[model samples]
Target: MRSRLAARLAALGACLLLTASCTSVSGTGGRPRPTGPGSLWNPSAGQPSPSGANAPFDADAALRRIKRLGFTADDEPGVLRKLPGPLRAIHSHCTGSVDGHCVIVLFFHGNDYVGYDAHGTGNSSVVSQDGTTVTLSYPHFKPGDPMCCASGGTREYRARWTDGKVTFSPPLPGNPNYEEPSP
Candidate 1:
């Protein structure tokens, strides 16, 4: 009777061990198979990154390239058909796109510089054109401006990529963030 009891206990221990490991077995003998098209060892060891496998685009370098491709005086002068129409309609039309970014400046006669017309009165604002990134400044409105207080800050408007020069300060009052959304 003692021997039988010992043999029964051993069998129960073996059964418990088997169930503990096999109860949750996915597919392999003792280990689980990958849930979804995965490998246990080195699945991505040889794979490349999902994005930007190649060198990242350099904006500064690319701008230099565009300057190299600058408009040639030899080519016939005409309106740019590719860029989205000017954000602010003026008398002239000259637009260009760089790396999906665009700048539409009023093209004028030889030696003529494109200047800001100051959209009507009361909406006077100053726009700074430094290479790209037009910084629209409204010094009158400090950090406490009604609208941009939380988001836009004191800046009334921000017109970026100003390819042309804003020679005049437009009359800006009553309204802040002068420049309308790029049309």
Candidate 2:
């Protein structure tokens, strides 16, 4: 309908105005505008592309931005609960037994990569685009349970992450509690 088209154009025009003022994309209607050369279009030219690991890692800044979007710390649980999710503390071959399953939770706390829980004690890992290899300084007496504090957990893990699912060694230790990110 013409009204809908006009509304879209109006919305687009307001976006252009905000972009012309070199506004940060962290407020109302906060989508990053595309970069281009026109006076009203190009907010930053020849500055730096704004993405990737090289980008500044500011947890506070990120947290502030996230909060401004009306999200509170407690809201995280509700949002996550609403979504059918992955990245849960679940994975097979967790025990590191000759045949046992394991689970690991990985998160980038402001780009400092950490992996823990349901797996080995957090140490010695090589993760690449191709795959992730987690080697424990000592062998895990129990593959997935780290709190047991049973010492000397050692192993070389060759893990392949496909579509978010992890498949390490076969017979991948069946577990009622284990779930991998959908590969």
Candidate 3:
């Protein structure tokens, strides 16, 4: 019985050690790793997190709120991707796109809809974020280039969230194919 008890204690100790090791984000000196984008703590985009922005995201609530925004009633709003940062952000894909691009990153503060990145041209679909800047990559078309294919190298634009809204660093790309969503 004593041997069995000793084995159980040893197993428990091993499990605890593994857990501690996994949870340790400190550096060699036991100081927490630098706090920044890649740090274990404060992984936000280096901006002061908005109020209640770190709260857990409630998908149902977000969906309900988004529906009221007059975006669409036919295309169901769905999460395309979730971004990492101090603020909870989701790249939502749904309908009601005027520029033919149906994806945009929606920002949320504690499941409450805040704002979203600017609409993308049909060519721009790749989105990424660094710090507080969101970048969108799209095919670049030189004069005379066909609409389907762009021979000019890809172009990228960045947008930043500030004062509770998204502002494009450069002006939004102009889409000749833009059309108003039919009522």
Highest TM-score among the candidates is held by which one?
3
| Predicted model with the maximum lDDT | 3
Please say which candidate is ahead in TM-score: 2 or 3.
3
Per-residue CA lDDT of model 2 for 1-183, tens digit only, reads 999999999999988875564323332133322223323212122223245334444344433333332222222433323221122111212222332222233322222222222222222332322113322122344445664353544444443333433444332221212222223
lDDT of 2 at 13: 99
Q: TM-score ranking from best to worst?
A: 3, 2, 1
lDDT of 3 by residue, 1-183 (tens): 999999999999998865453322344222111122332122242234244556544556656545443233222334422444434445444434454345444555444455544433344543666436667665666677776777766656666656655555565533312322122
Q: What TM-score fits each model? A: 0.20, 0.23, 0.44
The segments of candidate 1 whose C-alpha lies over 4 angstroms from its true place after superposition are 1-110, 115-117, 121-128, 139-153, 160-183
Pitting candidate 1 against candidate 3, the one with the higher lDDT is: 3
Error of 3 at 69 (Å): 5.6
State residue 172's C-alpha deviation in candidate 3, in Å. Answer: 3.2
- Runs in model 3 lying further than 4 Å from the true structure: 1-51, 64-82, 86-105, 118-120, 173-183
Q: Over 4 Å off in model 2, which ranges? A: 1-138, 142-153, 170-183
Candidate 1 structure, TM-score to reference? 0.20
Global local distance difference test of model 1: 0.29
What lDDT would each prediction earn against the true structure? 0.29, 0.32, 0.47
For residues 1-183, what per-residue lDDT tens digits would candidate 1 score against the true structure?
999999999999998875553222243222221122232122232223233212332223322222322211111223222112222111211123122111112221112222322211112233443333334544333355453233343443444323332222232232343333232
Residue clash pairs of candidate 3 = 44-86
